[model samples]
Target: MIADSGRSVAFTGHRTYDGTAAESLSAAVERLYGRGFRTFLSGMAVGFDLAAAEAVLTLRAAHPDVRLVAVVPFRGQEERFSPADRVRFLRAVAAADEVEVLAGGYRRGCYAVRNDFLVDRAALVVAWYDGSPGGTRYTLRRALARGREVWNLHPSGGGLAIRPVQPALF
Candidate 1:
């Protein structure tokens, strides 16, 4: 059970990024910790999700109360990952405080389902979206529709500055 949705954050982003994203993301996670967020949810995807999970783990050294929750979309989602990526994926999952696998096998739209699950439980979302249409954008829209605040960590948006994407006025 999530301790507090109000204090929980979900991470979503592109599968690839420049070298600068990791450092900025880490700093963003640390800042969020300072802002009283304790429960962090990761989609367990290859790039940003794994990086976000790792950041949370690193932050635990100084803030042990922080928690990382890995929300996997399916049972063998990591099977397609390269060997090195699989290792990184496993390491993050092993270190997570909680794991929630949404499906026993892969299915169409499982990722959307997983995104919905994360948004349902989080009051905040940290996205590395570049505004292109994709899973990251989908997750961002879902979060915004659910009234969760979003912080875009994409370098194009501005480095390490907590920019909150306000929900649409509609």
Candidate 2:
């Protein structure tokens, strides 16, 4: 079994999130923390990954036990990123309690490797997917297949709404 498989949560979402995403994720982090979840796994991608990690760090200020784990896909993942984006990513990584690099070098499936790694180590997944097929969708499916509780924060009526994924056999 993966480490922290029971006390951990993972995050996934689209890169383009609405303005309400930060608030929505903050509330979700607090709720999960109250439920005894302390370790959070973030894929460390651009959108939801960054937002969720920041939210966790914000919450950690009040709850010292909470941890932020940055699951970087591979070495030099930020090489092609803009300077500002790279700075943001570094800040998140520096603030993380642990940084797990899934691969020593970049490969075709590095992203999938990272996503699966996060899901494998987590019991709950908090996502902000907009129903588009991609890494987020794949991670969500994997999380559900593993019987993980998934809370999807989707935009609705100009705000975010929580939709929990029902556990089902694949």
Candidate 3:
């Protein structure tokens, strides 16, 4: 099922995180929940995606209405991950309320397709970005272009900042 954009949040971030990433993500999730975001979309990649999904799982214990959606680029996307990461990925997928695989197998630009899928369904994006160029930047730019609210949980220490949507430069 396609998520209700008004209530859905998409997450994007780096593949690795620092020590305080977990705590910061958990707090951000809690805040978003309090603001009535019921659905969270995770790209289901290794680092920040897994962290976001796990945080939602933790929150689900107290608020059953919170939904976690794992948006996989393709089936078996985790096959290349290390054994431990593969296990983590499986656990998150199993626990997710909904799993949407965009492709039957890995293909060129599949990851970008997955990212677009998340942004298309979510009105709010929660990002763990340090401003480096990559998928996170691409997704954030897409969200901005589409006028989605983006909350950046800057892992480098600036805390959560809600980015303003810029007016179209047409």
Candidate 4:
């Protein structure tokens, strides 16, 4: 996702860990931050969500003004987080300039609904996709349909490749 001044961006992706994919995602976040993005919205899930939030915090040390917005799908989603992971997540949320929870509890399909909330409010989306048909893929498809620019990070051999989509010129 291309960074725009005073606009927030959202992130979505698989909750599975892939080392190369994680590194690639960090690079993507750094690139966006360098482009003047100051606010990031993330669902605070495992894998990609945690990774993205961590990256944002690391960047914040350098860009003290950068903000990480935790857009949680429900309360106690942090219960699923590991002790250390939960600590980090809580720190991110406390340090966050803003927080928004889309639902009160984990309803069926709540994650997808949360994704839609993020997409609806974001100027762009940064997604990690392994070409699978899951919530992240569904969110990306929705973003495309709505003409939102997306930056998809796909895992390659021990690394990541970025594919960015721009709004079509009429």
* TM-score of each model, in listed order: 0.90, 0.88, 0.89, 0.81
Model 2: colliding residue pairs: none
Model 3 TM: 0.89
In model 2, which regions exceed 4 Å deviation? Answer: 1-3, 156-170
Q: Candidate 4, overall lDDT?
A: 0.74
Worst 10 residues of 3 by lDDT: 161-170
lDDT of each: 0.84, 0.81, 0.83, 0.74
Point out where model 3 deviates above 4 Å: 155-170
RMSD of each: 5.0, 5.2, 5.7, 5.7
Instruction: Flag clash pairs in model 1.
Output: none
Is 1 or 4 the stronger prediction by lDDT?
A: 1
Better of 2 and 3 by lDDT: 3
In candidate 2 the C-alpha lDDT for residue 123 amounts to 93
Q: Write the per-residue lDDT of candidate 2 for residues 1-170, one digit (tens) a residue.
A: 23567999999887776445676678888888889899999888877788888899999999999899999999888786678668878999999999998888899999998999988899999888777778988888888788888888664221223364322210
Clashing pairs in 3: none
Q: Which candidate tops lDDT?
A: 1
Model 1: lowest-lDDT 10 consecutive positions: 161-170
What is the C-alpha RMSD, rounded to one decimal, of candidate 2?
5.2
User: Cα deviation in Å at residue 155, candidate 2?
Assistant: 2.9
Q: Distance from true position, residue 97, model 4, in Å?
A: 1.8
lDDT score, candidate 1, position 134? 82
